[model samples]
Target: MPRKFYDGPQRDKPRENCAIFGVACDDIGYSVSKLLYSGLIALQHRGQEATGISLLETGGNIYTYKRKGLVSKVLNNRVLSKLWGNVGIGHNRYATTGAKEYSSSYYLQPFHFKNNEIEFSLAFNGTIPNYAELMKKLEDMGRVFVTNTDTEVIAQLIASLSIGTEDWPEILRLTSKFLDGSYAIIILTSEGDIYAMRDPLGFKPLCIGELKTGKRNLYFVSSESCGIDAVDGKFLRDVKPGEIIHISHQKDIHSEMVLRTNKTAICQFEYIYFARPDSIIDGVSVVEARMRLGMYLAKKDPILKNSEITDNAIVVPVPDSGRSVAVGYAKEAKLPYIEGLMKNRYIWRTFIMPGQNRRKAAVKEKLNPIKSVIEGKDIILLDDSIVRGTTMRQIVQLLKERGGAKRVHLRISCPPIISPCYMGIDFPTKSELIAAKFYNKYGDSYIEEIRKHIGADSLLYQTKEDLSRAITKSENELCRACLTGIYPLKSVEKIREIEDSIAKSRT
Candidate 1:
């Protein structure tokens, strides 16, 4: 009913970019909208900027409801009542590209495109690094685009490819050959058919699940296993890399390996920061992986094991993202683990807040030191990763200057981020990364310099080998491109160019 698309200014943060959810049920009476709402709510952490859902009715009419906001705010009971169907697809979006204007609702997906011949709604998670080139090719073929976002480009491309064939899997396989980056996308057609597909390299996460109600069985495809858990569904395995899964109106499911590659590049950040702790990704529990990271960090750093340090220092997590690893570190180091900093539950993530000033203010507002716990004590601070270093520096200053911490030793769960990410997690340019900037400025003394900059007594980062071990995956199987500068895809030059353009535009 809300036809007006609103656009607002953009923010920079370590974003998962988006989350996609889809379900098809054999029972027409099943409330697919409610199930989609539950699944999207479970994945709310993946994206808070916007939410959308597309439903296909039995008579071949497609309905979509979407708006810019949190899922709870955007999709209410009244809205859900309007989105009726046995099959539906949903999306939670955090803008990875395009202008963040109020009118940008045009970009909010499950994007629907309709014509006399065919119609479908698409929701996608992940970035297409070669979007400009792909868009250019489509434009050359006389395709018109309304939104600047890559989702529209992808949707149009799929529509164009679907022209000659009803074999959607084959069309997707052909589409996969032209796409050069990460994506896990779900599509709902007017005929009540749903299709889910992942990129060839598997840079993003997607999983399948099943829920049984009476005589009807419902199938789900989501960005994480937690979505399935939210709906009380049985956990099924991940959608294989380069696989296309189809769910028909009859609730029959089929999967095809449309693309194949020997190497898979699951984004490691999904374990370290992006995913819910309760979620299992790529056969690894995110919570356990974080704990292993702490154990590995403790084994690598003798200071954590030093009795003197452990006796006087209290292990404190940076709150939320750092909690799991801090607990792990405390156990391995034989130190006291305490909530030395209390997070203000009301505030949003500082990194996602728009502008440097707002981000700084949000960090101060979001975290407050427990003076009685931290005062006159040595503090071992555990955090997931250091991006811009602004928030970390602020926290160090808060603990020392305000809370009277004698010393602050910082430990990160992942290796230093030296390269930009193109697959969707938003650390787009080396220039915007504190580690890369410090490395460029201080050369071999970068680590010490960053420690000095953050006012930490000492700083230690996990090694790449240790990170791989922590996730229980080989280095080649993960996308550590941001840490090691070796991208899984061969579009490094193109990604850099795009990132540079983005950086300049931000300025």
Candidate 2:
């Protein structure tokens, strides 16, 4: 097995960060900041390391505050009251920086840029994998930068070139040309405009909505629909990938959909792990997708085949991400839903834990089986996806020994992730993935081999067809690259070569 930093007998691979949110308004009377807090809390699963909000008041002034903590801990009523504005954008971040300093810096997001002439702050949901190349381009142009964020990269690009142009579309066009990786950003400025744009691939999620007061309603944009629902906003639909939305009090609302490339490559992990269960992305309900995933797995895996999974079998979910899927599975498979795992609400995200050992310790402390819920019952364990089997194995052992489960049937809501994502998600390379490792050693397919190794009675996984069908839109409208290996952009030949060899895939 390819050893990872957090792989001991009881350790598991680290969890990936997820989630992003943005909101804007025209009037100053509303508690827009509090509204933003509600939205961020609902979208917290997308990211937990840091939470931030940026506001642009009516008087051409922008204020922003962000740090390494949860949304509630970082911003309270006192903090929100200090920054007064009708227009704002917020972000919850997952870490991409390898260093502890990079992870700990409060200066990371809603990354603000100011000069004698202009000022702006931005919060983004996706990654720009070619940020190194973009930084070189900016440095060549004499634009100085303070932080190591792709959010900063775009801010500098905008600050340097926005000289004579009052046009937001032109600014976006100039910036998008230099970026070769995924980015979905919200830009707030001294000029009272908030700009939201998804990359050409739609590798991140962004949506539009309206919030109603007594008389008139206000318009806004966000990464997920639940954020809008937090402030009593009704969802309109997803912002088209490769489109930019410009919102302001005075100017006519502006929108433009010009792509750096023609193809759209939305992230499959969003449907499987990132987005909130209540919110729909790209017209697909995340809750429904998870339900379908369980049903599909039931049809494919031997453990579920011909087994009378009635009210006797207890369905338990890995909390937060797996909750809705567990509910759906329990309902559809005619099983009893049991809240068996008790998550430590006090535990910080893996990104916030000071070291690798702390994160590994957290996985143990974060979940424990409720002995009463699983005593002497067959347990079907549901999780969003299993990265390395170490955590799953530990979790299963807990069910068998501590909770007295008769048998453990493992269920995953997504297909075996045979490839790493180059866009925004932070999954490790395939060499470290358990499914890939099992396939390599056994010289066979992954499903059965992984089940046997994990000590599960049987295992079931969602298929590419189930993933696609789970989305209401046509198959062509979604991105299944991680499962299908159909990358929509240019690949470093060596990385792709290694990925193909490890998966033993023909492509």
C-alpha RMSD of each candidate structure in angstroms:
3.6, 4.5
Q: lDDT per residue, candidate 1, 1-507, as tens digits?
A: 111111223233366778999999988876699999999999999988889999988687888889988999888988887778899999998754444353466777889998766799999988776787888989999999887667888888888999978888888888888888788999998878888999988889999999876788999999999999998998888988899998775847788665789889999999999999999998999999999999888888767557777778999999888999999998998788899899999876555566767876787888889999999899999999988787898899999987899999999998988886767776635676789999989999999999999999999999999999999999778989889887888665665667679878998
lDDT of 1 at 158: 88
Judge candidate 2 at residue 153 and give its lDDT. Answer: 77
Index of the highest-lDDT prediction: 1
Best by TM-score: 1
Model 1 TM-score (2 dp)? 0.93
- Cα-lDDT of candidate 1: 0.84
The 10-residue segment of model 2 with minimum total lDDT is 1-10
Model 1 ranges off by over 4 Å: 1-13, 97-102, 249-251, 352-360, 497-507
Reference-based lDDT, each prediction: 0.84, 0.71
Clashes of 1: 8
Clashing pairs in 1: 6-102, 6-103, 7-101, 7-102, 7-103, 8-100, 8-101, 8-102
Per-residue lDDT, model 2, residue 371, is 88
